[model samples]
Target: MAAEQAPSSNDVRTWERIDFHAHLLPDFYQRALTETGEAGPDGMSAAPGWNVQDALSMMDRTGIRFAVLSLSSPGVHFGDDAAARRLARRINEFGAALVTEQPDRFAMLATLPLPDVDGAVAELEYALDVLHLDGVAIETNARGLYPGDDAMRPVFEALEARSALLFLHPTSPPNHGSVSFGRPRPILEFPLETTRAVIDLVLAGTLRRSPRVRVLVPHGGGALAVLADRVATLAPAQMDLGDVDVIAELGALYYDVAGMPVPRQLPALLQLASKDRLLYGSDWPFTPIPIIEAMAAAIGSTDLLTDADREHIGWRNAVTLLPRLAALAH
Candidate 1:
């Protein structure tokens, strides 16, 4: 691996204006590709298409002062527990090293071999205690098991104990649904799956029990934002205890502006969520990084929020969620 360069004087354009979600492939994954000389699992984008330099350049151009990197979808689901554990360690270490090399520009969200509850718990400890990562990133469903499932209680317990930040990225569940039968992943399914996992966590008592636990839901919080009212009306028994309006409960959680660039969606989200709870995300490598600048500008242009609201959404909110960054501004 190459040494990371220090951020230039110009690089410090705006402290704390960071992107909370993006991804990278570790060296082990590259080795696996090199040794096997084969394309990875189908319907997955885990290939070595992007790297750290690309990420940094994007940040520089977009006026983003920092970024928190995490592993993308299908995380550790492709291998057995041992393989998954080893891969997660390598990825987490690489992420930590990247942050260390460029302390001014990066932070990390640790990856875990989830559903293997023991391994996930152990990985969380190692990543936080050893690597000093800011948070953990887990997919919507780990091998067909939702975060609400009892099997993942250990991971949740460990995270809740530490008030850890969890970045929830959506992945298609096993045999998700028919999407033209041949279409790849079906764009609709990603948001739908995210909605499913979000509801599962709320209804299964995960959110209520872990009040301190902060979760960053991707793709504009998926269908959960759109269907909050509908889910609220399902039944008192259908949801986790407390207010019937799941949408109101969601306001208690957090969201990133990863995919909600459309006019209607952003306003609806603002109406439902407090300004301080919204954060910025680029979904880089998938969406063009330059698009992030456009999104940021669009967000700035919205009358639904005040200048303070835009500033919070653009950066201050992330700083609040990631308390570790409190000292950097000086």
Candidate 2:
């Protein structure tokens, strides 16, 4: 397929980018937000403006070839299982429609009705088998139930059986009240919760049981990059993997640079995940287009990454995970 029209910026339009951590808000989800008058999921600010045209325009401008869309935080569940199941299907169908409309420009990570284990599995089958999505997007914690919860094992088993591409995103920790000192949840809370979730997931041994599951943690794996030793120290006592190297286990999973890949984040991310495991993400709509473009430039110029490594993170690494996007390589 021909590339989309280029933006005014003449930096270099030679390659296409794959965004592994973008989001979509269905009409129903938006309506719910409107009804509640929410500023967004963290309840701190309004949900960012989102629409396919805006997302695609930004992608074209920024050299992003394809984006894997997922529902943002405060996922499908709101204490009502029926609402969760219905919304999951509705939102997924909305995403599938986009892929159908523009196969090259859009693909989706199906949202699940999680913490409702059976509902999640059922949604997974429908989304994958029928809708043919790229994979599923799971929150770090679904309805306050982190990935490690035993109750969600069957769902993980189903995903593992398929060797699924599971994208893990952070949700606000349940102890929001205690942490808030007039600061929004995204500040220190988001990364801390993400760190806790990843560690807990590892401790639960979900990865061991689902060895084939290809996992991608967003925001450069949150604080997990520098927390390896802390995790390693705790792992031996927290879970019974007699002689396993905790760092190795953490390294095996993939991570995306959605937010700015600043100085502190770059080293740890590169050290933890090899070139092939680091993918690009804009966190579009939530992250302003200008910021995403700046992130791309910053990451592109950083000496910490060789040209080849940056190339893989920007576009090539994703081909291995979702072959459909590989067409761009030609």
Candidate 3:
């Protein structure tokens, strides 16, 4: 895997790179976190301050032509069902305005108030039908309840009915304190939680049933491909997977090259995901700017991907996943 010269800003300007896993931090959302006393939710530090211009500048510097935004971990839901519903609407509205302001450079996924099924279903309908947002972004677990829980079936059904895209982000796992050892959960637990949520969806038949609801898994499917074979071999006998082909099901979902995907995670991810299912992501504000730049450079320079594969992951695949992007292209 020889390295190629990183593309310069001029060179990058000519290409279309669509970031599918970027985030936004609206002022109202920050205030909600503080008011809820969840400023340090999941054991991480305070939320990073973000502004539209700064986000645009980062996209330009990294050669990203467009970014699909979502509200990140410890999502809009705090504890109160009503509060969660209100915050979800506020975040969605804020994101929709950004897209309206710059349709070519920005798109947004709607936030939902999960763990409150009826509210979530209503919000999903409004976000997709009324707001005309690209898709929905949801936490892997909503306050310790995984999306695959039977209680979430209606939400998945609603998404399928709309053929909506689902962006799955990870938050701290249930009872993470028991395993976290006082460290921030993102370091290790985030990936593990993503893996767990995906498997649960498969075992619960959520993925099988909701074929139209396209799911985008973050961080190269979060150690999922690495453990896929293990689950495929043992899950049926030990658990009640009931004929689910773990590898095939995993391969069907889209995955983003966020976090540290290059050198190691990407290879493992390819074992389960086809090249067309790969997408680029720069989990900005959460992953600092310098790291995002370095990761973008590495993706451009990595020899493991052919020029064709690079093109697909950079933007082609994203366009296929969200057709609205092609319409928005300049």
TM-score of each: 0.87, 0.93, 0.95
| lDDT of candidates 1 onward, in order | 0.76, 0.83, 0.89
The model with the greatest lDDT is 3
Cα lDDT tens digits, model 3, 169-235, are: 9999988889999999989999999999999998889999999999999999888988999989988
Candidate 2 local lDDT, 116-165, one digit each (tens): 99999999999998999989998888768888889888888888888899
Compute the lDDT for candidate 2. 0.83
lDDT of 1 by residue, 53-130 (tens): 888888887777788888876576464788778888888988898999988788999999877888889999999888
RMSD of each: 5.9, 3.8, 3.5
Preferred candidate (lDDT higher): 2 or 3:
3
In every candidate, how many clashes are there? 0, 3, 0
Which pairs, if any, clash in model 2? 39-45, 39-46, 39-47
After superposition, which runs of candidate 1 have C-alpha atoms over 4 Å from their true positions? 1-16, 30-48, 237-245
Ranking by lDDT: 3, 2, 1
Candidate 1 whole-model C-alpha lDDT, 0 to 1 = 0.76
Clashing residue pairs for model 3 = none
Q: In candidate 3, which residue ranges exceed 4 Å CA deviation?
A: 1-15, 328-330
lDDT of 3: 0.89
